[model samples]
Target: MLVHTAWNDLPGSVRRAVVARTGPVRSVTPAGAGATCRLAATLQTGSGVVFVKGILVGDRLAWTLRNEIRVNPHLPGIAPRLLWHVEQDGWLVAGFEHVAGRHADLRPGSADLSAVAAVLAGLAAAPRPGLPVRPFAARWSGLIDSWHVAGSTLAHTDMSRRNWLIGDGGARLVDWATPAVGPAWLDTAFTVVRLVRYGHSPADAEGWAGQIPAFSAASGESLTRFAGALADMWQRQQDRAPAAHRGLLVDAARAWCRYRSGRSAVLMSG
Candidate 1:
């Protein structure tokens, strides 16, 4: 588990570098360690509120911060703006336009579900930008075929509720620290798993995702294989870490895998 660095605990030079860009922080509320961020906080600055997230420059996963900076320009309304970045005293921090909003509700009958689907559809139709990012397959060890990273557009692999904020701008994604070059439809598929985790049945989750053109157009065989792969991966995660939250995902993944496997069997029989 990555420990969070308190805002006050940061070095004087590092804090100075951030304040220079944010314009004197009146109050700092620690945002906790996001995905791979070692330090995250929301600051009430003279100019406005800014969300800053960063990691130690010498940390093993510091590359994620670089990827966030590289991909920020490509995502417009779908993501918060990366106003600026600073590196000092072995720390790399990036300030983003703070978006005040609540985490999306993906439960059955939630209005946010449709909005989330719309966002995924728009992302799928977006033009692929040229960047030095690695393929999605590069992140996983032996899950290449399961990951299906051979598509043109980018993908936001992490689909947590907190990642999708519903605020003044409908929904805006945050923490693009580990985006990948893969099938845009894959992103929607990930959301389907989240929907199931949030109380939607496998069929309902699929139906909800089917509204998005990408998910609707995805190959059925690929979806089945992806479901099975996710179940196996999550099961392994549960065994290794035994985290309570991950255990919940393990159940969700297995449920989807069973549903998809049954669908595949029905299709073959017909």
Candidate 2:
């Protein structure tokens, strides 16, 4: 587990690094969420308040912070603006525009579903960033048909509810650390799995994801293949390291696969 750094306890060198860009810090409010970053807080600077997230310089996940900084500019309005970044002493910190909002409620029939769909649509429409990220389809290459693994869109592969913030402007996607290049509909499919974990039936989750034009336009066969690939992957992950959350994800993935298979059979019979 990552060790968290309290805002007031940050090293003086690190504080100076932040001060050089944002001016003197008036106050600091530590953020108590997210697993990847140990040092995250809202810094009240002389200019304004900004959300800053960081990790120890030697942490293996420090690369995630760099990745977030690299992708933020490419995301446009879909994510919070990356104001600045600092790598000093023994920490890597990046400041972002502070967005005040609540985590989206993705349960079936929640109004946040519409906002989530809109964000996914925006992600689908976004132009691919120039960075050379791995193609998402390659991750499941031989497990699924080759045709299912096509498209150049940037996908925010992780779509858990905690990553979404529902502000006055609808849903804003955060945590660009795990972005991938993949089919336009992939994120929506991932969202479907998460929706099932959040109490939606597999069918209901599929229906909710279908609200987005990109997902709606995808081939059912491709989606079924993708679902099976996800189920297999999650099952292996659970086997490798059993965790309560991973177990839930495994169940959700299988539920989605079964839903897709049943729907395919119904369509063929009809």
* Residue 65, model 1: Cα distance from true site in angstroms: 1.6
Residues 12-78 of candidate 1 have per-residue lDDT tens digits of 9999988888788899999788657889899999889998888998888999889889999999989
Off by over 4 Å in 1: 144-149, 239-242
TM-scores, all candidates, are: 0.94, 0.93
Across 1-270, the per-residue lDDT of candidate 2 in tens digits comes to 478888767788988888999988998888863577888899899989999998987988878788899889988788999999998888888999999999999887799988989989988977788888778877677788777967899998998888999999898999988778988998999999999998999988888787788899999999999999988988888855548888999999999999899999999999
Superposition-based RMSD of candidate 2 using all C-alpha atoms, in angstroms:
1.8
Query: lDDT of each structure?
Result: 0.86, 0.88
Best by TM-score: 1
Candidate 2's displacement at residue 262, Å, is 1.5
| lDDT of residue 198 for candidate 1 | 90
Error of 2 at 73 (Å): 0.3
TM match of model 1 to true structure: 0.94
Error of 1 at 187 (Å): 0.6
